[model samples]
Target: MLPRTSFPSAYRAAPTLCRRCLLRSMTARGQQSRFISTSWLEKQDEAKRKWEERAKLIEEGKIQHIWDTFKDRGYVKDLAGTEDQIKELMVQKRIGAYVGIDPTAPSLHVGHLLPLMPLFWMYINGYRAVTLVGGATARVGDPTDRLQSRVPMKKTDMTMNITKIHYQLKRIWLNVEAQATRFGYEKEPRIWNRAILNNSQWYASLSFIEVVSRLFKGMRLGPMLSRETVKRKMEKGDGMSLDEFVYPLMQAWDWWHMFRKMGVRMQIGGSDQYGNIISGIESIKYLRDTEPDPDQKLSDDLSNTPIGFTVPLLTDSSGAKFGKSSGNAVWLDQFMTSTFDLYGYFMRRPDADVENLLKLFTFLPLEEVSEIMEHHNQDPSKRHAQYALAYEVVGLIHGLEEAATVQDQHKGLFSKGGATEVSSYPTGGPPTANMASAFRVDIKLPESLVLGKSITRILYAAGLADSVTDANRLTQHQGAYVGGAPGQPAATNRGISTGELTFTPIKNWFPQDTRNFLVDGKLLILRRGKHFVRVVEVVSDAEWEASGMMYFGEPGTGRVRLLRDALMTGAKEGEGHDLSALSSPEARRDFLDRAEALYSDEAGRFKGLPSEAFMVKKTRARQILEQSFRVFARSGNQSAQAKTAAIDEVLERAARNLDGHVENYMAEKKRQEKKKIRTSRPADEKSAVRWV
Candidate 1:
C-alpha cells in the first residue's frame, strides 16, 4: 500500500468524512443536475398549490355539475384535476379536448367506444373535439399493457392502417352527430372545430437531439420507473426496453403540442392510461412554468392548465378486458364485423349486463331507460332490454337503416310462428308462389352438389363449418337446421298453407325428395346455430358446368400457378401475388383438365359430386387464379397485350356458352308448353293438333 502522505487529500479524508455530510453534498449536487432541474421541482409545488385551491372550490359545490353528466353515465373513472378546475376552464372558453388512438389495427373496436363517448359529448356541447391518430407513436408501439415489445409494423402497412383509421374516425363522428340529434340533442356540433390530426406531421421533422434536449429534460426517471407498467415488467424480470421507457415522454410531447397549437386543455383516455396522463400534465406544467416571462406563464393561470379525464376499461361480466388480446374484440368496421353479427353480439349479452349497457351505450333519457328496464324485468325472456340496447347501439354505429334491416332479419329467423314444421306435404302450393316474401339467399350452390348430398357436406361447402368433421359434429349435436325464410311473414295466406317458413332440424342426410324441401325448387336455408344462418340458391347443372369452364378458360394460368407455388412455400400472409410467371403450355393443359374433371360426368353432364368435394376443388382452382393475378399484377412481368388477348378469348367462349344455354332452356320450355296444350285439347281436336 502507498503511504498516506503520498495519497490524494480526498482519499486520506474518506474514513473521517461524516455520512450525513457526504449525502448532503450529493443531494445539493443532484438538485442542480440537468436531467431533473430545480425548476421542475418548483413547478410540482405550484401544481400542488393549484390542486389545493381546486379542492376548496369542489368542497363549495361549485364544480359538481361539471362532472355530473359523465359520472351519471359511468363515463368518468378517474380525473387528473379537481372538478372545479374543469368547470372553470369550460366556463371561461370553448377549450379543446382530445383522445389519441394508435392505429394498431385498421379498425376501432368496442373497447375504444367508452373513451370516445366523452369526446362526442364535448363536441356536441360546443367544445373543440380533436382526434389524434398516433401515426408516429404507433411505430414506437405503446408498451402500456404489453409484456413484450410489439412486432415493428412495415411502412406500407402502417400507412394503410393510418388512412383507414382516419376514415373510420370521420365516419364515426358523422354517425355520432346523427345519433345525437335523434337522442334529442338539438344543438348541431361545430363540424369545423372537429379535427383529425396525424402526429407524424410534426414527428417527421422533429430531430432526436431536439426531443432529448427539450422534452426529456422535464421528465423525471423516478416517477417513470415507479409507474405500475414499468414496475411490473421489472419485477417480472421481463426486462423493459428503452423505447418503452421513453414512450410516456413522447405522449407528453403530443399533449404539449396540442395544448399550445389547438387550445386543447383536456385529454381523455382509458383508466389504464392514468400514468401517461399524469406525465403529460407534468410536461405541460414544466414547460409553462419555465417560461421566461411571468405574464406568459400559462400554468400559473387555472383556466390554462391542462387536465386529463379517463373512462373505465370496457369489460365483460367475467371482468376480463375487451380487446384483441382477449380474442373478443367486436370491431366497429362493417367489413370486419357485419351489422347482423354486431347486432347479435349485443343481443346475446346476459340479462344482468343489459341494463347497465343501455345506460352506458345509449343516449336515451334516464327515465325512458328505467321504464324500459322495468318492462324488461317483467318478462326477461322477451329480451326487451336487449332489443333496445342492440337497436340503439347498432343504429349509433351503423346507420338506423342498417339496424332496421338486421332487426327484421333477426326476427324472421327466431320469432314465434315465423316458421312451421314440414311434417306433411303442402296443402296448396309451394311457399315460392309469392316470391316477394321468399327468404333471401346468401350463397348459391350448384344443384349437382346439393340434390343428393349429405347435410354435413352441404354445411362445409357453404362455409358454415370449418371441415366435414366439424359439420358432422354440428349435426350430431342438434346444431344444424334446414329451411327458414329471412323476411317478415306475409299477412295474406293466399293458397299457401303456411304464411311463414319453418326450419326443421337436419341430421346426417338431407331428405331424398329435396324438391319438397326447396323453396320454388331452388332455394335452401341452412342454419348452423342461433347465430349463423345461410340461404343457398341451387343453380342448374348447365350453369354450374359453364361457370367452371369459364373460370378455367381465363388467361394467366401460368402466373396463377407460380403465385400458388410461392404462397404454398410460405410467402408472408397478405403478400400481393399479381405478377406473371413463366409456365409451360403442358401446365396450362393440365390445369384445364383438372377444372373439367370437377364438374364433368362420363355422360358429359354435370357430375353428381358432394358439395364439399365440389367446393374444395372449385376453391383450390380459384385460389390459384387469384394468387397468380395478384403476383403478376404486383410484378408487372406480363405484357398488357398478352393479358388482354387472353381475357378476350375467355370472354368470347363464356358468352357463346351462355347464349347456347339460354337457347336450350327456352326451347325446352316451349316444348313443354306445347305438350300441355295438346293434352288439354279434346280427343277429336288432339288428333288434328299432332302434325307439328
Candidate 2:
C-alpha cells in the first residue's frame, strides 16, 4: 500500500508535482511556474535531454566523481566493492537491485541508511528496486559484527518490530519514489515500482527439509569460515556457532528469492554485506543452472537485469563510523531522536561527510550540491552545506512545512533563548514539534504570581521543587532560576508562580546578564542551568484554581508542607546534624555560608558529592526556607545595571575561580619539575643539595 500523507491538504495545495511531471511540463510548455523555479526547470530539461551522455559516462565506469564524493565525505576503502569496481559497473545497463533490512530493532538508524543509498540510487536511475524485510531472518539474528552473542528475539517482538519497520519503509520509499520518478522521463514519468516484501511470506511455509536442502545447495563451508567477520571472532576464542556460520547462506537465499520472484538481478548494500550479496548471487546461479530452460536465464536482456553493487559505509571527518551521536544511535523515529537534534546532528556534519551525504540522501542536482560545497568550504562558519543537508533530509522525511517549523523553533530556542518568542497555549493541548526534537506546549501559571501565593505552593505548582523544603534548598544553592533570573531570598517562602516558563538557551545564548527577561512573542521557555529546562505559560487565577481539569495546580498549603517534611526527613537521614542544630542564629549563618559555598562550587564538586548526601543538604535548606517563609518574601528590585555588567560579574567570578585552579596546578607542576631536577643529580651532589 502507498504511504498516506499526514497532511493531505498540503499536497492538494501544491498539486504534488513529481520530478518527472515537472520536467515534462517545463519541456512541453517551455514555461516555469513559481512552484517550478526557472533555473531548476532548465536544469531538469538539460539532464533529461542529455541522459544518454551521462549514461555513457556511467557505462565507461569512470568513478572519479563517485570516489571524490565518497572521499570528500570521509569514507575510506569500502569493505567489498573498490573504487575501480564501482566505476566498471556504472558503465553497464540499468540494474535491478535489492537491499535487505533486518528489523532487528523497532526502527532503522542512520547507520542503516548509509548502506541503503546504493539501492536508492539504483531505483532513481530507472532500475527496479526492492526492499526486503527480514521478518523471518530477524528471529535467527545474523551474527556478523557482534562481539558478544545476542539473545535470540521472541517471535512476537520480531513480528512487531517488522510491522513498525514496514510502515517506516513505506514512508521513505514513497518519498523516494516521488523524487526518483520525477528525475527522469518527463513525457511518461515512470512510477517507482518499489516493493516492501517479508521473507517470512516465502520462507514460512517451507519445511525444515526444504530449508536444509536449499541451505547446503549453494553454500561453501570453507569460504564461510574464511570470512573476516567470522574468522576474527573464532581466533579470539569467541566460538562461532552453527547458526552464525549459516547466516551468510540464509542471506544469500534472500538474493536468490528476489531474483526468482521479482526478477531482481542485483543485490546492493553496505560493504559489510558483500559476503551475503555475493553468496545470494552464487545461489541464484546454482539454482538457475540446476532448474529448467525458461528459469535458467531469468533475464533475456543483461542491460536491464544485470546484478550486484554496494555503497561504502558512511563516516565522519574523523573516520568514526557514522551512526552514533553523543553515544546513542541516531534513529529515524521522532521519539528516538528529536527533529531538531537530528537537524543539529546533520547540520554539524564535517564538510567531507556533507558532499557524500548529499549524493546518498538528497535528490538535489549533483552540480548544485557541488556549488554549495564550494561555497561551504570557502566559509564553513556559514554552514551552507550543512544547512542544505539538514533542510533536504528533514523536508524529505517530515515534509517541507514541518522542516521549516523545526528550523524556526531551533532559531527561537537556541538563538532567541526563551519561551516568550514561541507560541504560548494552555498545557495539555497538542504539542508543537520543532526540528523533530523539542516540544512546545501550553503551561498555565500558578495563582502566586498575582495572588499572595506562597513560595512552596508556586514551586509545587510549577513542578520545579517537590516540596517547600526542596524548593528552599534549590533556591538556597541558587540552582533554581526563573526566566534566567535568580529566585528571591528564602525568608519569604511563598513562591510567586507565573503561568509559563520557557526552556531557552540563556547562558549559552549569544551573551546575557544575571537577568535579561523578554517575552519575545508568546512562548515562555525557562532555563534553570546548563541543563535543566522548563517551558510553561501564564494564566488567570480562575484558570489556576479551576476543577474538572485535565491538568490542575497543586494545593498551595499541602505542597509547602510536603516539601518541608520531605526536606526535613532527608536532612536527618543524610546529614549528621538535624534541622534543630541550625536553630541558633549563628549556626544558621554558618549553614548558610556553607550552602553558598556548595552552590558556588557546584560544578567543581558535582562529581564528588554522594547522591544521597547532596540531596539531604539541598532538602534541609529547602525545609528551612519553607518554615521561615516570611524571610524570603522580600522581592528584590531588578538592578538597572547593564546586561553586560550583570553578566560580566558572574563570568569574571567563574574565570577567577578557573584561574585560581590553574595557578594551583602550575605550582604543583613546578614542584614536580624541581623534584625531577634534584633526583637526576649525581648521588654525591644530590646528598649535598639535600644538606643545603
Candidate 3:
C-alpha cells in the first residue's frame, strides 16, 4: 500500500495491463538467454555422455580402443579429434586407416616405424590397412618441418626406389605377421586386408585442373597459412616454393581420395605432421559436407568424421630426430645395415629408454614389459631389457631365424669367451665352431696365394696393415694374432683353450706351411687388438682365378690389387687381368690416357662399378698409399732426399697399376655395351625382307 502511493504516476496507470506487458517482456528476454546458454550446456552434456559411453565400452571389452592403446604405449602425440570421438568411432565399427610414405630413398629406416605401429595394430584387428606410397608426391616433396625444399629425385632413381620400397613394404607385412603370431596375436591370413598402394596410380591421371577444381576449392587459405610449418618457414625467411607451400593441399587430396574411394577414416603420421593432418581432416569434412553428388555426400553424423593420429617423432636420448635429414637413419635394408649391426643398434640403447622403446617397437605384453624393466633396474649392467628389445625388434624386421643367427654372431664375437657354438653358417653347412667365418669374411684369398705366404705379407694383403713394415711392427708387439677366434686369447703363443675349444695363435714372420694355422683347411682368423677382426677364407684356385683376386708379389714391391672382387665382377667389368705388362712408366702413362678418355665418357658412368663401391675402394687405396708414404718418409736407413725419391717411385708404380686396372675395366665395359646394342638391334633389312 505504501509503494502504490510512492509509485505515484506509474501506480495510477492500469496495473493489470502493466503487469501483463512486464511479464511478456521478461519472458522474451529469458527465452533469448536460455537458448544461448542451453546450447553450450547441451554440448557439454553430449560430450560427457560420449565419454561415459567410451569408458563403458572399454570396460565391457566391446572394442580394444585405439586411443587407449596408442596413448598408453606412448605412440600418440597429437590427435585431430577428441579422445571420445576416436574411441566411439572405433568402438562402433571397423574403420580403415592409412600411413603415407614417400619413397625418397631406396629403403625405410627406423624412424619410419613410428606410424607403422598403429597401422599394424589396426591391420591385425581386421581394419583396412593401406600403406600409401607417395610416388607422385615424392616429386613435390613434403615440406613439413623442412627448412628448404628437398633435392628433386631423378625419374630413374624414383622408379627404382618405388620398386624397392614396394618389395620392402610387402616383406615388412609378412615379417610383422610372423612376429605377431609369435606374440600370441594370431589372425587369419585371408582377413588381412592390406594394400601397398602407389599414389601415382591416381595422381598420374589427375590433371592440375582437376586438383584445383576438386581439392583447392575445399581448402581455406587462413588455416593453410596458419600452419606451424608455414609460419616457421616464413619467419625464418627461407624462400618457400609454391610446390612446398601447397604441399599440405596435395596431402589433403591424398587423404580425401582415400576416404572416398577406400573408406579410410584415419590417417597416422609423426607429430610434425599435425598441421598437415589437420588440413587433411578439414578437407575431408568440406568435401563430404558440400559434395555436389547427393549419393557421395556424407550424412551429418559424428561417426562419419575423419580422424587423424600423430605419433611422437622418434628421437634419440639426446633429443635429435632419427631420420635421413638428421643423417642418422638406421636403414631397414640388410645391405645397408647388416642384421648384426641392426641388432647391435638396439642393444646399445640406453637403459633409461629401454622400457619405452620396448612398448613402442615390440609387441610384448605390458605385464611382461613391466617384469623386464623390474629385472633390468636390479642389474642394469647385464642389459637384459636391451637384449630382449634387440632380439624382438630384429626378429620382427628380419625373420626369427636370421635373428637367432645374428644373436649367435654377437655372442661369439663380443662374448667373454671368443668361441661359441653356432647352429648355422652363411655357407649353409653344418654347425661350426668357426662362427667368425660363418657369418662374415673380411677377405677371401686363393689357397695358392696364401698357403706359402709369410704372415706379414698375408696381413698386408688382407688390408689389416698399411704396409709390410707396419705388419712387422704389429706382430712385434703381439698386437696381431693369427688362427684364433677374435677376442682375448690365452697368454701364451701356444694356444688358447675355452671349454672344449682350443684355438692356436701363430705369430711367426718367415715363410712356413700354414697348414697348422688354417681352420678346416679353408679359413684363417686374424685378430688385431681386442675388437678388429679379419676372417680370410681361402678358396679353390678355380674360384679365386675366376674372381678378381690378384697377387702381385710382396707388399714391399708396391704391388697393389683390388681388395674386393665386388669392385670388378659385381661391376660387370669382366674377369681379372694380368697387368704385369704395364711395369714401364711410359707404357703405363699411355694406358692411363686411354683409360681416362673412357672414364670421362657419359656412357661409362652407367657401365662402371656402383659409385659407392668404387669410392670405398678408391678411398682405401688412397689411405694405404698415404700410409706407405708416411712410413717410408720416416725411414732411418735413407737420407731425406733418397727417401722422397723412393716414395715417389713407389707411388708412380702403384698409380701405373691402378691405371692399368681402370683401362681394363673401361675397355671391357665398351665391349659389353657394343654387344648389348648388337644383340638388341633388329636384323639387317635384307635379312628380314623376302627377296621377291
Could you list the CA RMSD of all candidates, in the order they appear?
24.2, 19.6, 32.5
Report the C-alpha lDDT of model 3 over 48-130, residue by residue, as the tens digit. 56546755877698956666787789998888998888877876656789999988887789999889998998787657899
**Model 3: how far residue 347 lies from native, Å:** 0.8
Ranking by lDDT: 3, 1, 2
- What is the model-wide C-alpha lDDT for candidate 1? 0.67
Worst 10 residues of 1 by lDDT: 490-499
Off by over 4 Å in 3: 1-64, 415-692
TM-scores of the candidates in the order shown: 0.54, 0.49, 0.54
Candidate 3 differs from the real structure by a C-alpha RMSD in angstroms, to one decimal, of 32.5
lDDT of 2 at 667: 75
Which model is ahead, 1 or 2, in terms of lDDT? 1
Model 1: per-residue lDDT, tens digit, 125-235? 567899999887888878887776688876435544564566567667767778778876665322226888888777766798877776787677888888989987777
Cα error, candidate 1, residue 582 (Å): 35
Candidate 2 wrong stretches, greater than 4 Å: 1-94, 180-191, 292-306, 316-318, 323-327, 413-692
